[model samples]
Target: RSASNERAGRRSRPAERAGRAPAPRLAAATPPPAFARLGQAAATFSAGAAPTSRATRRSAREDGRRDASTAGSPLTRTVVRVLEVVPTRLRIALAALVGLGLLLGAATVVQTVRRRRLERQRRRLIADVGVLQSALLPEIPEHIGGARVTAAYRPAEGLAAGGDFYDAFELPGGRTAVLVGDISGHGRDVVPLTALARYNLRAYLEAGLTPRATLHVAANVLAPHIGDRQVTIAAAIFDPGMGRLTYACAGHGPPLLLGTDATPVTACSSPPIGAGAPTGRRQTTIALAPGATACFHTDGLDEVPVASGRLGREGVAEELRAVGPEGDSAELLARIVRRSEHQPDDMAACIITALPGGADRWCLRLEELEVDAETLNSGWAERFLLACGVGRPHLGTALLEAREIVARDGTAVIEVRVGEALAEVRVAAPPAVMLPIERRPAGSSAAAEAG
Candidate 1:
């Protein structure tokens, strides 16, 4: 009986403690504002996260309505009451509108990022192209082989760069070689070929090959690679010590000899390389008078647009004469740009001028041809020998020797070195090569072409 009574007392005491624990604290407590509850109820109907249960959401709205009625302003209470009666479709439409606005903002940000990335890529491409152009058309020094040398290049209006290129470098001996060439077309396709041609010709010239040999080798090498295109090329070997300029062309403009002489002989020509015809077959040798300037260029300079028509070879000569011995390639190009209304093609030019004060001007000159032994035996060969300073018994003996060598070897090389009053002719054995190497010999090197 005592145990039963203790259990009853323990249960009654807990009930008594619960009833007295919190009933006295109501007056001292700080209650939450009713308007704050109203705001929470508003958020539930907005684009915010949905309530976990519909029953819970309804109960909260009911509690907020009562709280608003008890303590909120008339406006707050009216809004809460309207939220409770709002249709489900209207709420969903409002949420959808908000989501659409967010999507549009995201799209705008993505587009801005993409545009910036593309702009950076464009700038990089431009920089790379600039570097490539510099490699293909490099800058050269002011002098080569003791003569003032300058070069210029200009692309057409629509091209960043083009097919034309030029180079000038000192050779193995005290000679200087200048090269200029034009590929038939333009754009990216031509740049690789331009580099190939420029460097290939330069390599041969640097290796002590004559201008004619250089072109011959270059023509064969490039023919296989250059599809449906031709390379018009010119190369010159200038010996300042010897005061002589020897040059050859392959379907390209001849080097202009200005100031002292009118121009280079251009009547003879080998077709452009890669044209299914032989090149480097012939070369012209000229004596350079002091104060003389040699201009080597691609055809574009002569083809520049002018008031009357294209700038012809005459115009080029006139410009060089105006620029005179003192002017470099840069100055000459500047004048051309000013005179030209537009450039129709890529132009490249190299200018080489001999020193003003030098030794006595050379009077001996030979622009030759390959004549038959009969022609050499003719009276013409005798006069030629006499003019070369060969006399009497030796002249007869030299003529007989030339005939015998021409008949025996099918051809031999004749080297002529004539000074003020002295002329010397040498008949030398030809070098071993695939083609007849004309070092100013066989005027059949086309018959080594006799002059």
Candidate 2:
């Protein structure tokens, strides 16, 4: 009877139980969007999968624990959360920047490699060019035609090459030819001309032409093509047979005679070739005694700096004298460099030392000049005759004859040979090639005056 009544009371309290509040919930609020989606994916994974054996399930659970541990790391979790929230476009742009940086690094490496290769090639080419340029100024032999020869070539500071050039070679008839000259400018425009002038002068000298004649023809040949550039050349022909060195200047420094006290002949100084002046009109010949040395050089020696002023010819002579005949051209240049502060131009020199007892020393010197007959006057002739060391009586006689000869011919060549005892002056007709096209001014003799 009690069991039946309990059942009837439980049924009657159903409505009250139903009206009471449900048990308190474990979680009240919804998860965030990222977690919510993750939970959904987990539910789907659980429902779609087939049942697995115990061993597989155990391995899966172990992997899941490991994955959870890794995901729980603070830095990793933060990075993952940031990535999940980041916009797709921003991620793509970041990827593009990384790829571009990689490409740029590769390009930079390639460019650097190319630049190094080019630098190596440039250095090699420069070295090769230096060798070729050296060929332009050759090494002279120790002796030519029984005369000791020495030479030196020094470009200006910080230069590989310049206009200065020189050569000494054996000529026909047991003679030797020496040439030294300087161009006005540098670079491609002048290199070929320098070579051309040097070789051409040598050929002319070898072809049995006098030093004055060789320069005369070269002046006319090179003048028309030189444009504004000019060349100053000093040439010499040594006849070991005659023991004489006949030298001439084309607006160049006079040759320095070593171990001699006599003054250098400076009469009838010729102007430079290409200067439109009467070039190669004057030449001087001197006797080179046994054991004598003669130096042929460019104007660089005269242009050095000193305490008083520019180191002129006298200064250069002093230096050469100090060096003495025993020294060579290279040694001479070295001494000059040590003494002077600088060299502004290219320096080149050719020195010839005569063998002792080579030939009889005449103590004879000669000077010759080609003058315009129409322009020849008494005053100019007097100065020239006096400069030639002609005495009063001979001067009067030579002047009278020069006037008569000039009246007869268009031009006269005055040949003066000075000896230890006497001076011989002879006036005669000049060669057709030497006749001047125009009359010289009255004071043209000023440049010809001797110091």
- Local accuracy of candidate 2 as per-residue lDDT tens digits, 1-451: 9999999999868866788865787988877999999999999999778677899887986686557546777887676556556687998898899999999999999999999999898677656545555579878888788588899977665334577889999886667788999988766677788898998888778666788888889998888777899999999988888878888898887788875545556865778888877678778888776678888888887887877778888887788888788888898888777777888776888889887757756577888876765336536556666787889999888767777777778667788898887899988876654422455675776656742
Best by TM-score: 2
Superposed by TM-score, candidate 2 places the C-alpha of residue 329 at a distance from the truth, in angstroms, of: 1.3
Query: Candidate 1 residues 127-193, lDDT tens each?
Result: 6655576578877887677577889876666535678888888885667788988899866888899
Candidate 2 local distance difference test against the native? 0.79
C-alpha lDDT of candidate 1 relative to the true structure: 0.74
- Ten-residue segment with the worst summed lDDT in candidate 2? 430-439
The global C-alpha lDDT for each of the candidates, from Candidate 1 onward, is 0.74, 0.79
